[model samples]
Target: MDLSSVKEALAEKSFDKIADVCDNLMLQVASKGTAFHDDWPYAIHLLGYFYVDDCDSARFLWKTIPSSIKEKKPEVVAAWKIGQKLWTHDYAGVHGAIHGYDWSQEAKDLVAAFSDLYTKRMFQLLLSAYSTITIPELALFLGMTEDDATTYVVEKGWTVDATSQMVTVKKQAVKREQKVDSSKLQRLTEYVFHLEH
Candidate 1:
């Protein structure tokens, strides 16, 4: 999927579409390690961690997963370890001493849904505001270069300057506290940070 296309879809307030796109991108992370793949899963994990009130350790996991293991479930276990550590800190998120999680299909579905919804809605909310209201100002928001923003607009076909239309700010996204999943934080930490202790 094209970044510009995805970005455009986000700006258009098509969150469910973005989530589907993100799911595909996530599969790439599980398989290929694309740059887009690098961000979201770990970010979702960190959000789960943040909701649980321990971002520091979660941040650690965010930085670790890439270097940890090549398989999917070890990746899940690795993240769980960090999350458990964050829950209690002393050998917290590790395998033997996990905090509290039932191995249920519903729980798995919930986690998957939460992670997808969190990132999809998060980006859509942000981009929609920019595309509808303050597009020109988004470079400041992202701290990206003007050329990049211009390119984004050109490729994505966004209004880029919605001077003629007045978009009503709809309550599409329900605000919620994001807890970083210690599990994710731990994986990224192992893969990205290469922690040695």
Candidate 2:
């Protein structure tokens, strides 16, 4: 297995190619039983899964990795911690966890990728849950400044109420029939008839 090629792919952010390479390497390891004792393949696989937001598979890989290998490669464990936080919707924790450690270049790249993905997911969830939200609240949730958050909401086609400092998502318009009071109509007709006579 060309581990260096896998590393290169990861550094370049070629996630699909990394997945393919990891799958092939996993198969070879399954058939041949550990060609090399180093855990780079497993670490790379974990990172690939994290990049794709496959938290469950990444956790599975983490669980299966040998204790010695995990100790030797603490970066993998740190990456998994971020993935765990991400899976549980602890976006703040994810950010804090990533910054709490000095990770390898590959791990840092993975963190950056996950941060982008997490921000998108958070924005989607916020939009779904609230038709109108204050700019400050949205900014805090997305870790953005209020101005940037307002801009983002406006860019997504949601209306921003500058006076109220709120972002509003217009719900789909519903057509409703105007109801007429029959008794009021009858009285009005009678009054009109009397006046005409």
Q: State TM-scores per candidate.
A: 0.23, 0.68
147 Cα displacement, candidate 1 (Å): 28
| lDDT (tens digit, per residue) of candidate 1 on 6-121 | 45544554433543454455566557655544324443344345333454656565556664332544445544554555456332123232223443331244344433443343
List residue ranges in candidate 2 displaced over 4 A.
39-43, 134-137, 145-148, 159-165, 170-197
What is candidate 2's lDDT per residue for 1-197, written digit by digit as tens? 45777778777877756656777777776798765567466655776776676778777777878888878877767777777777787766776766777867665675577667667877878867888888887876676778887887778788988899888965545799989999999999999999999
lDDT of each: 0.45, 0.74
